[model samples]
Target: MTTTLIIGGSSGIGLATARLLVARGDEVHIAGRSAQRLDDARLALGDAGTDVATHVVDALDAAAVASLAAKRAPVGRLVLTLSGSEGAGRLAELDLAALRRAFDGKFWAHLTVLHAALPHLAENASITLLGAITARASMPGTAGLAAVNAAVEALVAPLAAELAPVRVNGVSPGYVDTPWWGMVPDADRRAFFDGVASELPTRRIATADDVAEVVALVATNPNLTGTVIEADGGARLKAA
Candidate 1:
């Protein structure tokens, strides 16, 4: 069974992918910032048996991440899906703190994981980073997200090359239905998704399962690296 380490596995795409991996008989070690959430995930995935382990980690905490990485044996697959939210205002009115917060959480935290875990990554192992469709198709109030996501994509490319023999790739998901959407106000969430769904060629937003499957593929495909799989239900096409 493949041994995988998943950072930010408490919820959303990360949690979904952890469940999928466990179900497939892979040994999964999940980490997140919430002890309660990790415990809840461990309980929920109990049916997958003892192959699942959860750790409490703040990806932004370099020392904490290094400590967690040290606790595990060499890992065959490393998936980082750390998430953060930022400004809701126009670029001209953007909140600098919000921008920095988002960048630090999503982009820098991802880097921290790689820096700390690189030595522990097994040869031929795969690394997957999460990006958003907003990075490619811009929208109002998403300037910070776009910038950070693009940086993630760019960051992974060279790393993929540098880490060769150990593959690195990214998954840029569209509007996957997850708790991250909970960040938006309830009244606007449905309408916002509806509008996004209407514009996609599939006429529906992506499910966590859709993105999870892509993540799985990236993790297992040794031949694939430095590529961003756009699992967005053709949202990119619709955007054109």
Candidate 2:
């Protein structure tokens, strides 16, 4: 059985992906900062929870992340679904500290997990990184987010080459309906989703499952190294 480790798997895209992989019979180990949320996620996986394990560790805590990775050595598939919108705003007016926080939370966090698991990653294992379409699209209020995600996307090609048989790929989703938008009030979030859905070429905001399918594809397909699969509902095709 393939042992897969997913950071930030307590909720949202990470949890959705874990559900998919669990259903597919992978030994999925999920790590995050919230014990309760992790427990909930495992329960949410239903009877397949037998294939799931939960660890409470923040991605920002390098030592904790490293310890978890070491304990779960020989990980065959590594998926990173950690990111944030902390630094989102107009570039000129954006607080530099907030941008740094975004980087720390997203870019550095991803790297921390990657490096921590580097030694223990199985030979010919695959890595799937979850970023955002904002990395490529020229959006007005997402410059910081763009920078953070772009830094992540930037790792695909080079790492794929360096890692050789170990595949590296990225999944950049547009605006998925996930807990990432929990900060926005429910009504406002719904309205925002409706507005974005109308503007997208697909005419619908993606669900976490939608992006999870793409992540699974990237992780399992041997020929997909260094490729970035955009599951953005055509957001890049038409700016919002």
Candidate 3:
């Protein structure tokens, strides 16, 4: 059975991806910072009698992240869905400290996990990093978000080359409706989604499952390395 490790798999796109992979019969191991969330995820996955493991580890902790990867050595597939939105704002008004935290939490965290998992990666392992549409599209109030996600997308091509044989790709989604938006009240969130859907060509915001399909594609497709797939519901086109 393929052993897959997913970082930040407690909620949102990460957890959604784990569900898909678990359903596909992969031995999935998910990690997150919250023990309670991890337990909940494990139970959810286990209820279906799927093979799933949960680990509690913060993305920012280098040693713990490395240890998790080390323990899950020979991982056949690795998915990174860790990120932060604390840096979302106009450049002039952006909190520099928050921006730094965003980078540390998302960009650097991605790299740290990748570096830690490098040695343990299976010979033909696949690495899928979750980026965002803001990286390539012109989106106001998302300069910091773009910077962080752009950095991740920038690594895809070069890393695919460097990691040769081991495919490295990215999935960049636009305005996905995930727990990341829990801060917004349910009614307001719906209104926001409605507004965004009206503006988007697809007429709807993507769900975590929608993005997970793309992640699963990149994870399983043998000939799709060095590419960043966009599952933005045409938001990129609209932004363009």
Candidate 4:
């Protein structure tokens, strides 16, 4: 069976992709920061015909990421849907420490996992990094996030070239209704989502499954590499 490793697969897009890939016949291995969450994801995939495994490897910890990457066998595909607090809000008053934390969560951690996992990658393996619409579009309170995401997206070209037959790409999704918004009050979150739905050309926010579908494509498509696929429901077509 083809082995696919999903980092940050305990929830959101990662987990959704795991379920989809498992259904389509792949040996799925998921990694998360928390043991409980990893167990929960495993339970969620219970009784699925395909094999699914879980590991507790915090993306923020280099040693943990290396260890997890070392143990896994050559993977045919890799998906990273890692999440972190982006310290959203006006930049002038932003907390420097939190800003640093946000960067560490995604871009830095992604490199950590990729570098370590390189040795175990199968020929023609695919790597899809979960990027963001923030990378290309301007949104209020997301200045820091935009920069961080842009940096993450920037890796595609160089990494894809370096990885060669191992295709490297990014899937940039816009405003998904994921747990990433749990910090927002219910009413405010609803208002925020409603606002996006109102203006977006697709008249809806991207969902975990929506992005997951694109991720699956990026993984399986042989002709694509060194590219960042935008799956933002046409939000970029609208202005800031």
Candidate 2 per-residue lDDT, tens place, 1-240, comes to 889999989888898999999888788999988898988887887887767899988887878877887787788999999977689889789999989999998999999888878888889899999889999998888888898999999999999999989999999999899888888999999998998898889999899999999999999887889999999999988864
**Which residue pairs clash in candidate 3?**
none
* TM-score (C-alpha) between model 2 and the true structure: 0.96
RMSD of 1: 1.6
Q: Write the per-residue lDDT of candidate 3 for residues 1-240, one digit (tens) a residue.
A: 999999999888998899999888898999998999888777765664247788888877878878887887889999999988598999889999999999999999999888878888999999999999999899888989999999999989999999989999999999999989988999999999999999998999999999999999999899999999999999989988
Q: CA lDDT, every prediction?
A: 0.85, 0.90, 0.90, 0.85
RMSD of each: 1.6, 1.3, 1.2, 1.6
lDDT of 4 by residue, 85-119 (tens): 76577788887788788889988888788887878
Residue 172 of model 1: what lDDT? Answer: 93
Q: What is the TM-score of each candidate against the true structure?
A: 0.94, 0.96, 0.96, 0.94
lDDT of 1 by residue, 34-80 (tens): 99988887776667635688888889888887777767757888999
Ranking by lDDT: 3, 2, 4, 1
Error of 3 at 169 (Å): 0.4
Q: With candidate 2 superimposed using the best TM-score fit, by how many Å does residue 219's alpha carbon deviate from the native?
A: 0.7
How does residue 168 of candidate 3 score in lDDT? 99
Query: What lDDT is obtained when candidate 1 is compared to the true structure?
Result: 0.85
lDDT score, candidate 3, position 146: 93
